[model samples]
Target: MRAFSGSRLAELCLVLLACWLCPGSALAETRVALVVGNGAYTSTAQLPNPSHDAEDVAASLKRSGFEVLQGINLRQAEMQDLTIRFARAASRADVAMFYYSGHAMQYNGVNYLMPIDAMLTDEADLKRFVRVDDIVNDLQQAKNLRILVLDSCRDNPLAETLKRSAGATRAASIGRGLSKVEAPRGTIVSFSTQSGQVAADGTGRNSPYTTAFLKHIEQPHEIGDVFRDISSDVYDSSGKTQLPELSLSIIGKFYLNGQVAMTVAPTAPQAAPQPDPCAAAEAHWKAAESIGNVSAFEDHLARFSSCSFANLAKARIEGLKQKTVLAPAADGARASGTKAFDGNYWDVTLNCPASGKAQGFTRALAATVTNGVFHAEGQNPGGSNRLEIDGQIPADGKTTLSARGTTGASAYTLNNLAPGSPYAFTIDAQFERSRGSGKRNEARACNLVFVKR
Candidate 1:
């Protein structure tokens, strides 16, 4: 080798040092994304912006070195297949992302993303739909970080016209917007707007949310900060009507545009800093509220121990227990032949027959009768467990009892199997009992039984 000057030797040494110090010398981790847009709906209004959103997002992700799988207007079967494939791809990825733009429904706090070919009726039959929970479960297999972005809070037209079948006692609460989601550690769930609110499809080619996302996603900043910038941009673009929310639990830094810095030497272990008691309590409280379950509340109380909202959480837990435990108990009473419908306590059990391609189903109701009005609480076999029914029981006993759904619940069509009227029941010794079933227009059969308590 030829001898070099002092300056050249120093320059060569500096270059070598830089190579050893930089993380770019090593291979970058892989980033994978699954993007789906379902705008073509068979039973509801077609969305105009979802497909465009997916395409634009995919292009941006590809530019940032993400292996993107983009799909448009996928049906239930196709959507399922795509998710399964995505799961396999994500299992080896360092960062896995899922972006969905479509119609979503929330029933009993569980969110379901509807496929393009889904014909959602009044009933909340989630067996065929892709649940958000299932998506989270699939993404949880990723080796590193996970990101879930949902821009599917558009106004749903199907929610208005969808009616629950007759003889079904409980109807699921069909809300307008998607509900809040609880994500696991190392995962972030971002929403186009706050929970229980709808988002606007902008006049431009891309939605306001997607437009903002595209603008900030490639910025050379921490990924969480990028989302914060996007949130601010969307909030302003939507005229303050929309507020994007991010539920983050990421542990380390994730840069979309560049390589992460490497720590050359290990640092000494230090005492962990104390967490702010109020802040920790609030975070737990918010999670419980989003989940809206008794177990969540109970866990919060157990962990926080002395939070300010501990009493309030306890109260909510008690109320949820009543709904969960008491309502099912009523159904159990009817099923086990311990309770019946009468003048004092009207327990009407209705079943719908399988008519014209529909399956047969049954519903049970337990109500307290006062005056001539019958106040009922019903539960469906495959639907909601908290259905409230209000009807009038005739004094003649020959007349049929017509009941309707109340409190944001769906109406039950008690169709009589025999000719004349749909309501067929008996007034035994002391109770008003109905012991016949009927069929509705749908493919399911309806049956009714009345017993006295």
Candidate 2:
């Protein structure tokens, strides 16, 4: 029987040769990554952990087929250069990832992603140092999956007097100016903490949460599934502390090293970002110029120093100033009666043909008018409120204030509004129950009515 079988050995050898000799049989190589860890804040607390974390994650991403570029403690110019390079890489790569761990702060409302060396002593310092949208939107245009992991929510080290005036309460709740921007399609953005929550930069060699993240990233699973495990792991490790909230509006599932998912986690939802004012200001500037309201155009530019429309605002304002023109004469001043409402000695005088509508004001919360805007002050326990303006708030642009609203708690919402009509706005910011322990309670929101004055 053995001798008979040997007669066909040449045929079997031929078959085996055919199976092993195929070309173009491998999958495309997955190129990905931009890992940034900025831990050297000159003005505030130094984050020793982020640099280590960046180094670690960068190595991990590289091992999995990422054509990695690493930047650490970059001065302003280096940071911008890296961002530009990262964007270029993303456009061609199969997958793009951005990881930043460092100090970040939000002011006037726009969030600034701070490098370790950043010191926000003056509002203008932010313009010189950090380039937020450049980094985010660049990756947005990538051909494949876009993944951003920002552990940049550390305690702002800017001197107390130099802080951005967007009312913040706890170390955890200090706004990092991230909420106003959107992670584009095919992107998954995860913060170390919730949007309004601050994550702990642990006292250990690495931040507790980030250490957990690094641990799970290499595990055999889809990135999203890995994050769920990371989220659970971090929570358990931190003794049931704040858990990470994943906000995703991804077109499809993204894989690590192109390994198709063995596990799928429920993706998070993307919050439609409130409007951007610079986006509006650019249009508004053109509108004002079209209407020949030089004065109006000039005024809008002065307040929004950091808007994406800053240059346009500056140029337009100079033109208007040189022309020395005023708004048309038909818009005469009107005198509406005065109504002053005082809460905690904060008084607002609503005068002149009312500047707009009365009922547009929200009754649910408190309100106050300062610098011609309404805000509900003292609504939260520490009096922090966030008043998002109408229209898209430019990622880095100027905002024209139409009306300001805030509760006593301190979250202020100022609409870079048009003086279309006189607005009669009212805000009642009453304190409600705490949302959770070790966290400030949510303040009430009030609507303001602006009418023609």
Error of 1 at 12 (Å): 7.6
Regions of model 1 farther than 4 Å from truth: 1-26, 122-125, 163-169, 259-453
Task: Sum up the clashes in candidate 1.
Answer: 19
Per-residue CA lDDT of model 2 for 129-236, tens digit only, reads 565556666676667777778786656657343544423432233334344343456667777765546678898878876898788887756565566566666666
State each model's C-alpha RMSD to the native: 13.8, 19.8
lDDT scores for all predictions?
0.67, 0.53
Best candidate according to TM-score: 1
lDDT tens digits, residue span 1-453, model 1:
799998777777776765643433445677889999899888789988899999999998988878899899998899999999999998888789999988886654457898888876646456678988778877888878899999988887765555344123333245457766645678888889877688987778888899999899988777866776777688767766687756677776677785434343338886888986755765676667655678889999898767555655666677688767775554444343223334565566766555322345566777675544556666444443345544434443323333432111212222121121112121112133543232221112234555655
- Stretches of candidate 2 off by over 4 Å are 1-29, 164-182, 257-453
Q: How many clashing pairs per prediction, in order?
A: 19, 78
> What TM-score does prediction 1 earn?
0.55
Q: In model 1, what is the error at residue 54, expressed in angstroms?
A: 0.6
